[model samples]
Target: MSHSIAIIGASGYTGAELIRLLATHPSFEIKALAANSKAGQSLGAVFPHLRHLDLPDLVTWEEIDFDAIDLCFCALPHKTSQEVISKLPKTVKIVDLSADFRLRDPEDYRKWYGNAHGATEMQEEAVYGLTEFYREAIAEARLVAGTGCNAATGQYILRPLIERDLIDLDEIILDLQCGVSGAGRSLKENLLHAELSEGTNAYAVGGTHRHLGEFDQEFSALAGRPVEIQFTPHLGPFNRGILATAYVRGEAEAVLEALQQAYAEEPFVVVLPMGETPSTHHVRGSNFVHIGVVADRRPGRVIVVAALDNLCKGSSGQALQNANLMLGVDETAGLMLAPCFP
Candidate 1:
């Protein structure tokens, strides 16, 4: 029952994470590790923490034998993912952890990413990888697109409300605080320790963030109309997790009821008791989502908050979840590890 797997971007944060999770996986074997820049380097050299896993050394994607891999997790950056995945063997199932195939329309992809999609044919069949709602499709999909960590956090709180008509569509506002790791393993002057510690600043203001394409596509489709939400994302000082606070117009009881009902059977999503709020600390390093609902002081207003590890549940862990379904493994396989907490 072992599924041979390969990671195309093995030197990045998400790639390291996939190796960490798959290290203890019951049915998945890491067959190849690809990182073009780090080619010929051992996984231990690029990632000291993973030195104990005995995984394959990093290599160029072009050198991989796709015939030997059952599923390939493409952890490359946006534009690069589409190009690499489009050229991958059609026999291998793929779980893409980039933003490449998330948007179904090439026009939407171009509008947000400022480039034409190189794999429109693949996009047409790529299933959205929000495992809670898209599980069935993912189980049957050959290519699955992992959602943005921020987008996943927001949708976890808002999707049920929108679907059940529990919230006012026009009044929905999402304010998120994301840890630095969500930016990936890339280096930037703004992310320097001295520059980011003990401070917080919002970026991508005025609906300019790329993840808005996800919200626009998902929310609008759920509501059967063009539903636009006011979303603002802030870069936090820490290294993991995402906390999203959603402001909406709705009856607290009804909204809470809808969320509780929506996630009642979901394994990874947890709906907390009313009046309790979640913290990014609780769900860090795990494929778990904690959601809390609180009634606002103003009548007809309620606040919904969700917390998850941007690296785990929000990305790599999410990619692994979909890969399991696509391979006919248990949905929660290799994903039951408890959250790391202080």
Candidate 2:
């Protein structure tokens, strides 16, 4: 049984990444590719790298026949996704790659995104698509919301420890560095190669990053208390990947054991050997997430580092992982490509 799929906002980085992975999927077919500005253009015109595949010409979302599409992957921007997805057919199973539905509380959405959620009903129904933690829920959901790249990397390292009460929640701090692509395909003066290359700097500093909402929501829910961590994000010169280093107060061995046990059955998460750290280069361009735990020189302190492709495991790959459950296909299908290395 082939599932006919539509990808909205198919001209961006994440949208192109979804096409890259889904192009090889055995049970899924790309039926519609929508990009309002790029409508009527061939997909290859906007994304030359994808020219090798046969794909639908870019169309406006309004021109799509949702009734014929079994699934939809909404890769639009934050506010845009909410507006577009609200108008989509109810029968379509959607995996949204935007922040529109990731947070549960509408108030939280407003606080972070600076506007009222356009689609509260769908917001209430969206399952958080952090595949490992929300598997069963995602498998049954009609709309699954993908997690933020930085949020995904940080959660992979801390969720298990928080769940088992292995770490001191009060003292946790997440310092993450991400490639420029995670900022999306939009053009900004600061993102220009002349400005960003050969240099890196932190933005959204002092607990100001938007992904803190996710950290607060997920970590607090797991610990059954109000948990807040100091989060700071930096933009690196590279093109892809995220490396999140979490400073935690706990026994190193215990942290390693907790992560290993929690992700033991997960197909995409790998807990590297104790004391060995992971590098973003190792997990580049793949759906796999690599986590490493090591002891800090100070007693009872440890550093947990997690690495993954910001676009893959952090967004598109995770969207597909949830889609597999929603479509009742093997979770690892079309996602077995090995990490690229130079």
Candidate 3:
């Protein structure tokens, strides 16, 4: 029997991507969709791209009877997500695509987000949903907190090296180029086509971006100390990917070997040959992540590059992957399609 599911915030990009993936999943059925503002409208009306799928019309959250849902994907915004998720029935599994429960400490959540965590008790059991590194814990978790797209891409490049103690942590730097969609479906003067297209500008410069909190938490926890990296994200003219270039103090060969050994058997992460760099176009619209490494001309320096679709392996695709593990289904199910190319 197919596991029945509910998708809250179905009108957004990540939510729509979840519907796109779950539409073809063999053992999952989307039984409800909630987009309060778009309530009573057909999914087709909100997102014409998904018009062909036989999906439930968007409804308000209060209208759904949670008893029928075997799993739920909470794609709502930060504060909103915690509020809604706190009210869910404990029996239903949840995969939260927001930043609400990603941090293990309520104090860190408050320090970074500037507000108290609405669901402090819930944070106690929310597994970090990076999939590859947290697979075992995710399989046993009822609530999984999805990592930020930028955070995930950077981790794919740095986590292994940190785990192996192969790199100088104090000198790590991550420079990222991200798609505008990572900003979300909301309206912003800067995101307008006429303004964003044909141009590239760096936001979150000088270390103020919210995703830095995730990096600090994950990397620090891995290194058994506070490890901070200089991170700056540039908004590219493209629509759906993140390309991160990390500069670390390590030998090129050692960095390559660490990355290769870590993700060799993983289904979703691929490491390119030494000296070869990956492009966002290669992993666009797919659940795959491609990583590359190169030795800098200066001794004791190396560069690692990682690319992935911000919407896929980054957010919604990640949420679906965690949902699969929680449901005891194949981790690759409904997410094995090849990337879209020109």
Candidate 4:
């Protein structure tokens, strides 16, 4: 029952996370690890925390034998992922953790990423990797595109409301606070310890954040019309989770009822009791989502909030969930670990 696996961009945060989770997977075997720049280095040298695991030394993608691999996870940067993935053998199934294939249309890709897509044909075949809603499509597809962490957080709170016709499409506003890790493992002056600690600031204000494209595509499709929402994202001082609060015009009782119904059978999504909200601390390091709904003092105003690990459920964990479906294995395998708490 072992499914051979390989990981490109194995030196990145999402790549490290995939390795961490797969270490305990009963049916997945890590056959190869690729990180071009870090090629010839042991995975331990790249990530000391994983130094204890017996894994392959890093190698360039070209050195790996695709014939021996069942599936591959690509954790490269946006434009780079499409370029590398396009050259990979079609025989290998792929789970891409990049912004490259999330937007199905080539035009939308250009609008958000500011570059023409390198692989439009493959984009057409890739399924959006929101395991809860696109479960069936993912099971049958060869490539699955992981959503933006911000996008996934917002959707978890808003999708059901939109699907059940319970909210005003034009009046949705999502305010999110994301841990510094969501920005990736890359180095930047703004992310320095002195500059980022003990403070919070909002970035991508006024609807310019790229994840809005996902919100537009997904919500519009569910509503059968054009739907646009105001989204503002903030950078928090911590290092692991995302807390997204959505403001919408709807009846609290109905909104809560719809969310409960939508996730009633979903293993990873938890709908809290009415008037009860969730905290990022409760869902950190796990592939679980906690959602809460509350009625505002002003009637007809409803606030829905959701929390989850950006690196886990928001990206790598989500990729693994879809990979299990694509591989015909149990959907929850290796992913039911309880959230890490204080």
Q: What would the TM-scores of all predictions be?
A: 0.99, 0.99, 0.99, 0.99
Model 3 stretches astray by more than 4 angstroms: none
Give Cα distance to truth, residue 46, candidate 3, Å: 0.7
* Model 3: lDDT of residue 271: 94
Clash pairs detected, candidate 4: none
Candidate 2 pairs with clashing backbones: none
Q: For residues 1-342, what per-residue lDDT tens digits would candidate 2 score against the true structure?
A: 999999999999999999999999999999999999999999889999999998889999999999999999999999999999999888999999999999999999999999999899999999999999999999999999999999999999999999999989899988999999999998899999999999999999988788999999999999999999999899999999999999999999999989999989988999999889999999999999999999999999999999999999999999999999999999998999999996
Q: Candidate 3 versus the native: TM-score? A: 0.99
Q: Best candidate, lDDT-wise?
A: 4
Superposed by TM-score, candidate 3 places the C-alpha of residue 204 at a distance from the truth, in angstroms, of: 1.3
Those runs of model 1 whose alpha carbons end farther than 4 Å from true positions after fitting are none
Number of backbone collisions per candidate, in order? 0, 0, 0, 0
lDDT of each: 0.95, 0.95, 0.95, 0.96
Off by over 4 Å in 4: none
